[model samples]
Target: MQLKELSGQSGVSAASIKYYLREGLLPAGETVHATRAQYSAKHVERLELIQALRRIVGLNIEQIRGLLKMADDGAPRLTVLAAVQRVVLHLDTAAASGDRPTPAADAVVRLRNWPDYPSDARNALNVHLELMESLHIPVTRELLDTYSKAMDDVAGLDIAVTTAPDSVDQLILTAAVGMHMHSQLLLKLLALAQASHAIRRYEEDA
Candidate 1:
Protein backbone atom coordinates (compact mmCIF):
# COMPACT_ATOMS: atom_id res chain seq x y z
CA MET A 1 0.00 0.00 0.00
CA GLN A 2 1.08 3.55 -0.67
CA LEU A 3 1.08 6.33 1.91
CA LYS A 4 -2.45 7.38 1.04
CA GLU A 5 -3.71 3.83 1.18
CA LEU A 6 -1.90 3.27 4.47
CA SER A 7 -3.51 6.38 5.86
CA GLY A 8 -6.96 5.24 4.75
CA GLN A 9 -6.47 1.80 6.16
CA SER A 10 -5.00 3.00 9.45
CA GLY A 11 -7.51 5.86 9.86
CA VAL A 12 -4.60 8.14 10.47
CA SER A 13 -3.96 11.08 8.23
CA ALA A 14 -1.07 10.90 5.78
CA ALA A 15 0.48 13.95 7.40
CA SER A 16 0.20 12.37 10.85
CA ILE A 17 1.58 9.10 9.54
CA LYS A 18 4.54 10.91 8.10
CA TYR A 19 5.04 12.66 11.41
CA TYR A 20 4.92 9.32 13.26
CA LEU A 21 7.43 7.88 10.85
CA ARG A 22 9.74 10.81 11.43
CA GLU A 23 9.27 10.58 15.19
CA GLY A 24 10.15 6.85 15.16
CA LEU A 25 6.68 5.95 16.43
CA LEU A 26 6.05 4.01 13.25
CA PRO A 27 8.87 2.38 11.32
CA ALA A 28 9.46 3.32 7.73
CA GLY A 29 7.80 1.24 5.09
CA GLU A 30 9.81 -0.42 2.35
CA THR A 31 11.42 1.94 -0.14
CA VAL A 32 10.06 1.39 -3.63
CA HIS A 33 11.65 4.51 -5.14
CA ALA A 34 13.38 7.72 -4.07
CA THR A 35 10.06 9.22 -3.11
CA ARG A 36 7.67 6.29 -3.03
CA ALA A 37 7.32 3.66 -0.32
CA GLN A 38 5.20 0.58 0.19
CA TYR A 39 3.48 -0.20 3.47
CA SER A 40 2.39 -3.64 4.60
CA ALA A 41 0.02 -5.16 7.13
CA LYS A 42 2.72 -4.69 9.75
CA HIS A 43 2.57 -0.95 9.26
CA VAL A 44 -1.16 -0.98 9.62
CA GLU A 45 -0.94 -3.00 12.81
CA ARG A 46 1.73 -0.72 14.27
CA LEU A 47 -0.33 2.32 13.44
CA GLU A 48 -3.35 0.81 15.20
CA LEU A 49 -1.27 0.17 18.30
CA ILE A 50 0.12 3.68 18.23
CA GLN A 51 -3.34 5.13 17.82
CA ALA A 52 -4.71 2.98 20.59
CA LEU A 53 -1.95 4.12 22.92
CA ARG A 54 -2.26 7.78 22.05
CA ARG A 55 -6.00 8.20 21.66
CA ILE A 56 -7.43 5.45 23.85
CA VAL A 57 -4.86 4.96 26.58
CA GLY A 58 -4.04 8.68 26.84
CA LEU A 59 -0.28 8.30 26.69
CA ASN A 60 1.96 11.10 25.61
CA ILE A 61 4.45 10.60 22.79
CA GLU A 62 7.33 10.01 25.19
CA GLN A 63 5.34 7.47 27.23
CA ILE A 64 4.32 5.70 24.04
CA ARG A 65 7.94 5.72 22.89
CA GLY A 66 9.13 4.12 26.11
CA LEU A 67 6.33 1.53 26.00
CA LEU A 68 7.16 0.66 22.39
CA LYS A 69 10.77 0.21 23.36
CA MET A 70 9.75 -2.18 26.12
CA ALA A 71 7.53 -4.10 23.73
CA ASP A 72 10.40 -4.49 21.27
CA ASP A 73 13.01 -5.39 23.85
CA GLY A 74 12.54 -9.18 23.62
CA ALA A 75 11.49 -9.37 27.26
CA PRO A 76 9.45 -12.28 28.55
CA ARG A 77 5.78 -11.99 27.72
CA LEU A 78 4.68 -11.68 31.34
CA THR A 79 7.34 -9.06 32.10
CA VAL A 80 6.25 -7.00 29.12
CA LEU A 81 2.68 -7.43 30.30
CA ALA A 82 3.54 -6.12 33.76
CA ALA A 83 5.05 -3.02 32.21
CA VAL A 84 1.94 -2.53 30.12
CA GLN A 85 -0.26 -2.91 33.21
CA ARG A 86 1.77 -0.33 35.07
CA VAL A 87 1.39 2.06 32.17
CA VAL A 88 -2.34 1.47 31.93
CA LEU A 89 -2.77 1.90 35.67
CA HIS A 90 -0.82 5.18 35.59
CA LEU A 91 0.88 4.02 38.78
CA ASP A 92 2.32 6.95 40.70
CA THR A 93 4.46 6.31 43.75
CA ALA A 94 4.52 10.00 44.56
CA ALA A 95 0.73 10.14 44.87
CA ALA A 96 1.02 7.56 47.63
CA SER A 97 3.16 9.80 49.82
CA GLY A 98 2.54 10.68 53.51
CA ASP A 99 1.00 8.14 55.90
CA ARG A 100 0.62 4.97 53.89
CA PRO A 101 -2.74 3.24 53.61
CA THR A 102 -0.86 -0.06 53.61
CA PRO A 103 -2.09 -1.60 56.87
CA ALA A 104 -5.73 -0.87 56.18
CA ALA A 105 -5.52 -1.69 52.47
CA ASP A 106 -3.45 -4.80 53.12
CA ALA A 107 -6.09 -6.05 55.52
CA VAL A 108 -8.59 -5.98 52.65
CA VAL A 109 -6.11 -7.60 50.29
CA ARG A 110 -5.40 -10.36 52.72
CA LEU A 111 -9.13 -10.90 53.16
CA ARG A 112 -9.52 -11.14 49.39
CA ASN A 113 -6.52 -13.47 49.25
CA TRP A 114 -5.52 -12.36 45.79
CA PRO A 115 -2.18 -13.97 45.26
CA ASP A 116 0.56 -12.44 43.10
CA TYR A 117 -1.08 -9.03 43.22
CA PRO A 118 1.39 -6.20 42.62
CA SER A 119 2.31 -3.83 45.43
CA ASP A 120 1.64 -0.86 43.20
CA ALA A 121 -2.03 -1.88 43.18
CA ARG A 122 -1.93 -1.62 46.94
CA ASN A 123 -0.40 1.81 46.62
CA ALA A 124 -3.16 2.85 44.29
CA LEU A 125 -5.78 1.78 46.81
CA ASN A 126 -3.95 3.67 49.50
CA VAL A 127 -3.96 6.76 47.32
CA HIS A 128 -7.71 6.55 46.99
CA LEU A 129 -8.18 5.96 50.68
CA GLU A 130 -6.02 8.97 51.43
CA LEU A 131 -8.09 11.11 49.09
CA MET A 132 -11.29 9.97 50.73
CA GLU A 133 -9.82 10.81 54.11
CA SER A 134 -8.83 14.27 52.92
CA LEU A 135 -12.44 14.81 51.88
CA HIS A 136 -13.47 13.92 55.47
CA ILE A 137 -15.38 10.92 54.29
CA PRO A 138 -15.70 8.04 56.68
CA VAL A 139 -13.50 5.06 55.75
CA THR A 140 -15.24 2.17 57.39
CA ARG A 141 -13.98 -1.41 57.31
CA GLU A 142 -17.36 -2.55 56.00
CA LEU A 143 -17.09 -0.11 53.11
CA LEU A 144 -13.60 -1.26 52.28
CA ASP A 145 -14.66 -4.87 52.42
CA THR A 146 -17.64 -4.31 50.14
CA TYR A 147 -15.65 -2.28 47.65
CA SER A 148 -12.82 -4.80 47.72
CA LYS A 149 -15.19 -7.61 46.88
CA ALA A 150 -16.62 -5.68 43.96
CA MET A 151 -13.20 -4.71 42.70
CA ASP A 152 -11.98 -8.27 43.03
CA ASP A 153 -14.73 -9.33 40.66
CA VAL A 154 -13.83 -6.59 38.21
CA ALA A 155 -10.13 -7.39 38.42
CA GLY A 156 -10.88 -11.06 37.87
CA LEU A 157 -12.87 -10.32 34.75
CA ASP A 158 -10.13 -8.06 33.42
CA ILE A 159 -7.49 -10.65 34.08
CA ALA A 160 -9.55 -13.33 32.40
CA VAL A 161 -10.01 -11.17 29.33
CA THR A 162 -6.41 -10.06 29.00
CA THR A 163 -4.95 -13.47 29.77
CA ALA A 164 -7.01 -15.19 27.13
CA PRO A 165 -5.04 -17.08 24.50
CA ASP A 166 -4.02 -14.46 21.99
CA SER A 167 -1.02 -12.97 20.29
CA VAL A 168 1.15 -10.60 22.27
CA ASP A 169 0.06 -7.75 20.03
CA GLN A 170 -3.59 -8.56 20.60
CA LEU A 171 -3.10 -8.74 24.35
CA ILE A 172 -1.30 -5.43 24.39
CA LEU A 173 -4.02 -3.87 22.26
CA THR A 174 -6.70 -5.17 24.57
CA ALA A 175 -4.90 -3.86 27.63
CA ALA A 176 -4.75 -0.44 26.03
CA VAL A 177 -8.40 -0.39 24.99
CA GLY A 178 -10.15 -2.68 27.43
CA MET A 179 -9.54 -0.70 30.63
CA HIS A 180 -11.06 2.46 29.22
CA MET A 181 -14.00 0.55 27.80
CA HIS A 182 -14.53 -1.27 31.07
CA SER A 183 -14.67 2.00 32.99
CA GLN A 184 -17.36 3.27 30.67
CA LEU A 185 -19.23 0.00 30.91
CA LEU A 186 -19.23 0.20 34.70
CA LEU A 187 -20.61 3.73 34.64
CA LYS A 188 -23.45 2.74 32.33
CA LEU A 189 -24.23 -0.33 34.36
CA LEU A 190 -24.39 1.74 37.54
CA ALA A 191 -26.75 4.24 35.93
CA LEU A 192 -29.08 1.52 34.76
CA ALA A 193 -29.06 -0.18 38.13
CA GLN A 194 -29.75 3.08 39.90
CA ALA A 195 -32.65 3.86 37.60
CA SER A 196 -34.16 0.42 38.10
CA HIS A 197 -33.89 0.70 41.86
CA ALA A 198 -35.41 4.16 41.83
CA ILE A 199 -38.34 3.05 39.69
CA ARG A 200 -38.98 0.09 41.97
CA ARG A 201 -38.81 2.16 45.13
CA TYR A 202 -40.56 5.37 43.98
CA GLU A 203 -43.05 4.44 41.26
CA GLU A 204 -46.73 4.46 42.37
CA ASP A 205 -48.99 1.43 41.98
CA ALA A 206 -50.17 1.21 38.37
Candidate 2:
Protein backbone atom coordinates (compact mmCIF):
# COMPACT_ATOMS: atom_id res chain seq x y z
CA MET A 1 0.00 0.00 0.00
CA GLN A 2 1.12 3.57 -0.57
CA LEU A 3 1.81 5.97 2.28
CA LYS A 4 -1.55 7.63 1.81
CA GLU A 5 -3.34 4.29 1.94
CA LEU A 6 -1.37 3.21 4.96
CA SER A 7 -2.12 6.45 6.76
CA GLY A 8 -5.78 6.27 5.88
CA GLN A 9 -6.06 2.65 6.92
CA SER A 10 -4.25 3.19 10.21
CA GLY A 11 -6.15 6.38 11.01
CA VAL A 12 -2.81 8.07 11.56
CA SER A 13 -2.21 11.34 9.77
CA ALA A 14 0.22 11.21 6.84
CA ALA A 15 2.58 13.76 8.40
CA SER A 16 2.59 11.93 11.75
CA ILE A 17 3.30 8.65 10.00
CA LYS A 18 6.20 10.31 8.20
CA TYR A 19 7.46 11.66 11.51
CA TYR A 20 7.34 8.18 13.06
CA LEU A 21 9.23 6.78 10.10
CA ARG A 22 11.81 9.54 10.39
CA GLU A 23 12.22 8.91 14.11
CA GLY A 24 12.91 5.22 13.44
CA LEU A 25 9.89 4.12 15.40
CA LEU A 26 8.29 2.79 12.23
CA PRO A 27 10.27 0.91 9.58
CA ALA A 28 11.03 2.59 6.27
CA GLY A 29 8.72 1.62 3.48
CA GLU A 30 9.94 0.25 0.16
CA THR A 31 10.76 3.06 -2.24
CA VAL A 32 8.66 2.58 -5.34
CA HIS A 33 9.34 6.07 -6.67
CA ALA A 34 11.22 9.23 -5.79
CA THR A 35 8.36 10.36 -3.57
CA ARG A 36 6.31 7.25 -3.07
CA ALA A 37 6.84 4.40 -0.68
CA GLN A 38 4.98 1.13 -0.20
CA TYR A 39 4.03 -0.02 3.28
CA SER A 40 3.14 -3.57 4.27
CA ALA A 41 1.11 -5.31 6.94
CA LYS A 42 4.03 -5.12 9.36
CA HIS A 43 3.93 -1.35 9.12
CA VAL A 44 0.24 -1.40 9.82
CA GLU A 45 0.67 -3.60 12.92
CA ARG A 46 3.54 -1.48 14.23
CA LEU A 47 1.56 1.70 13.70
CA GLU A 48 -1.37 0.22 15.62
CA LEU A 49 0.89 -0.75 18.50
CA ILE A 50 2.40 2.73 18.55
CA GLN A 51 -1.02 4.30 18.60
CA ALA A 52 -2.10 2.06 21.48
CA LEU A 53 1.02 2.95 23.44
CA ARG A 54 0.38 6.64 23.01
CA ARG A 55 -3.39 6.81 23.32
CA ILE A 56 -4.20 3.92 25.64
CA VAL A 57 -1.03 3.55 27.69
CA GLY A 58 -0.36 7.29 27.94
CA LEU A 59 3.33 6.86 27.18
CA ASN A 60 5.30 9.84 25.90
CA ILE A 61 7.07 9.76 22.56
CA GLU A 62 10.42 8.83 24.06
CA GLN A 63 8.95 6.06 26.16
CA ILE A 64 7.04 4.79 23.15
CA ARG A 65 10.26 4.74 21.15
CA GLY A 66 12.06 2.74 23.82
CA LEU A 67 9.16 0.30 24.03
CA LEU A 68 9.19 -0.12 20.28
CA LYS A 69 12.89 -0.87 20.33
CA MET A 70 12.45 -3.45 23.06
CA ALA A 71 9.54 -4.99 21.22
CA ASP A 72 11.41 -5.20 17.95
CA ASP A 73 14.43 -6.72 19.66
CA GLY A 74 12.25 -9.67 20.76
CA ALA A 75 11.80 -8.73 24.38
CA PRO A 76 8.84 -10.55 25.83
CA ARG A 77 5.64 -8.92 24.67
CA LEU A 78 4.26 -9.98 28.07
CA THR A 79 6.54 -7.52 29.83
CA VAL A 80 5.54 -4.65 27.61
CA LEU A 81 1.95 -5.72 27.72
CA ALA A 82 2.07 -5.90 31.52
CA ALA A 83 3.48 -2.40 31.78
CA VAL A 84 0.89 -1.05 29.40
CA GLN A 85 -1.83 -2.80 31.36
CA ARG A 86 -0.51 -1.27 34.57
CA VAL A 87 -0.60 2.20 33.05
CA VAL A 88 -4.09 1.69 31.67
CA LEU A 89 -5.33 0.34 35.02
CA HIS A 90 -3.87 3.35 36.77
CA LEU A 91 -5.50 5.66 34.25
CA ASP A 92 -8.84 3.97 34.63
CA THR A 93 -8.75 4.17 38.42
CA ALA A 94 -7.23 7.63 38.60
CA ALA A 95 -8.84 9.35 35.64
CA ALA A 96 -12.40 9.26 36.87
CA SER A 97 -13.25 11.86 34.27
CA GLY A 98 -14.01 9.13 31.74
CA ASP A 99 -10.93 9.72 29.55
CA ARG A 100 -11.42 13.47 29.23
CA PRO A 101 -9.00 14.57 31.96
CA THR A 102 -6.50 11.75 31.63
CA PRO A 103 -3.15 11.86 33.39
CA ALA A 104 -1.38 12.19 30.05
CA ALA A 105 -2.93 15.59 29.51
CA ASP A 106 -1.80 16.77 32.94
CA ALA A 107 1.62 15.10 32.72
CA VAL A 108 2.38 17.00 29.53
CA VAL A 109 1.83 20.27 31.38
CA ARG A 110 3.54 19.25 34.64
CA LEU A 111 6.70 17.86 33.02
CA ARG A 112 7.14 21.15 31.20
CA ASN A 113 7.45 23.00 34.53
CA TRP A 114 8.91 20.60 37.08
CA PRO A 115 12.32 19.04 36.58
CA ASP A 116 12.76 17.19 39.87
CA TYR A 117 10.24 14.38 40.04
CA PRO A 118 11.18 11.02 38.58
CA SER A 119 9.37 10.59 35.29
CA ASP A 120 7.40 7.48 36.30
CA ALA A 121 6.27 8.83 39.67
CA ARG A 122 5.46 12.19 38.15
CA ASN A 123 3.24 10.50 35.61
CA ALA A 124 1.52 8.52 38.37
CA LEU A 125 1.00 11.65 40.41
CA ASN A 126 -0.51 13.42 37.45
CA VAL A 127 -3.01 10.60 37.07
CA HIS A 128 -3.82 10.72 40.76
CA LEU A 129 -4.39 14.46 40.68
CA GLU A 130 -6.55 14.26 37.60
CA LEU A 131 -8.58 11.49 39.16
CA MET A 132 -9.10 13.52 42.29
CA GLU A 133 -10.02 16.62 40.34
CA SER A 134 -12.63 14.78 38.31
CA LEU A 135 -14.16 13.23 41.41
CA HIS A 136 -14.22 16.62 43.15
CA ILE A 137 -12.09 15.10 45.88
CA PRO A 138 -10.16 17.68 47.85
CA VAL A 139 -6.43 17.07 47.71
CA THR A 140 -5.31 18.14 51.13
CA ARG A 141 -1.74 18.02 52.37
CA GLU A 142 -2.73 15.35 54.87
CA LEU A 143 -4.16 13.21 52.12
CA LEU A 144 -0.92 13.55 50.18
CA ASP A 145 1.05 12.55 53.26
CA THR A 146 -1.03 9.41 53.68
CA TYR A 147 -0.62 8.53 50.04
CA SER A 148 3.12 9.10 50.22
CA LYS A 149 3.44 6.82 53.21
CA ALA A 150 1.48 4.07 51.52
CA MET A 151 3.55 4.36 48.37
CA ASP A 152 6.76 4.29 50.37
CA ASP A 153 5.74 1.05 52.08
CA VAL A 154 4.71 -0.61 48.84
CA ALA A 155 7.85 0.59 47.06
CA GLY A 156 10.06 -0.87 49.78
CA LEU A 157 8.46 -4.28 49.43
CA ASP A 158 8.55 -4.11 45.61
CA ILE A 159 12.24 -3.28 45.68
CA ALA A 160 12.99 -6.17 47.98
CA VAL A 161 11.06 -8.64 45.82
CA THR A 162 12.39 -7.37 42.52
CA THR A 163 15.98 -7.24 43.68
CA ALA A 164 16.17 -10.83 44.84
CA PRO A 165 19.03 -12.27 42.72
CA ASP A 166 17.75 -15.66 41.69
CA SER A 167 15.75 -16.17 38.51
CA VAL A 168 14.35 -12.71 37.97
CA ASP A 169 12.59 -13.96 34.87
CA GLN A 170 10.84 -16.69 36.80
CA LEU A 171 9.81 -14.23 39.47
CA ILE A 172 8.30 -11.91 36.92
CA LEU A 173 6.53 -14.78 35.26
CA THR A 174 5.16 -15.94 38.59
CA ALA A 175 3.97 -12.44 39.43
CA ALA A 176 2.33 -12.04 36.06
CA VAL A 177 0.53 -15.35 36.16
CA GLY A 178 -0.23 -15.33 39.86
CA MET A 179 -1.69 -11.88 39.73
CA HIS A 180 -3.82 -12.87 36.81
CA MET A 181 -5.10 -16.17 38.09
CA HIS A 182 -5.35 -15.69 41.84
CA SER A 183 -5.16 -12.06 42.72
CA GLN A 184 -6.88 -12.38 46.07
CA LEU A 185 -4.86 -15.44 46.98
CA LEU A 186 -1.62 -13.65 46.16
CA LEU A 187 -2.66 -10.73 48.34
CA LYS A 188 -3.46 -13.09 51.15
CA LEU A 189 -0.08 -14.76 50.88
CA LEU A 190 1.71 -11.43 50.98
CA ALA A 191 -0.36 -10.26 53.91
CA LEU A 192 0.33 -13.42 55.90
CA ALA A 193 4.02 -13.26 55.18
CA GLN A 194 4.22 -9.65 56.32
CA ALA A 195 2.30 -10.38 59.51
CA SER A 196 4.48 -13.36 60.34
CA HIS A 197 7.69 -11.41 59.75
CA ALA A 198 6.48 -8.50 61.83
CA ILE A 199 5.54 -10.79 64.71
CA ARG A 200 8.91 -12.52 64.61
CA ARG A 201 10.75 -9.20 64.66
CA TYR A 202 8.68 -7.91 67.56
CA GLU A 203 9.33 -11.08 69.57
CA GLU A 204 13.06 -10.85 68.91
CA ASP A 205 13.14 -7.19 70.02
CA ALA A 206 11.27 -8.00 73.22
Supply every candidate's count of residue pairs whose N, Cα or C atoms clash at under 3 angstroms.
Answer: 0, 0
lDDT of 2 by residue, 78-158 (tens): 455455435433432443333344444344444344344334435556666776777998766555555455545664565
lDDT of 1 by residue, 17-128 (tens): 9999999888888999999999999888888989998888888898778767766675666776666766776764437462365666777877788663655666677787
Each model's C-alpha lDDT?
0.78, 0.61
CA RMSD for every model?
3.3, 13.8
Best by TM-score: 1
CA shift of 51, model 1, Å: 2.0
TM-score of each: 0.79, 0.41
Compare the candidates by lDDT and give the number of the best one: 1
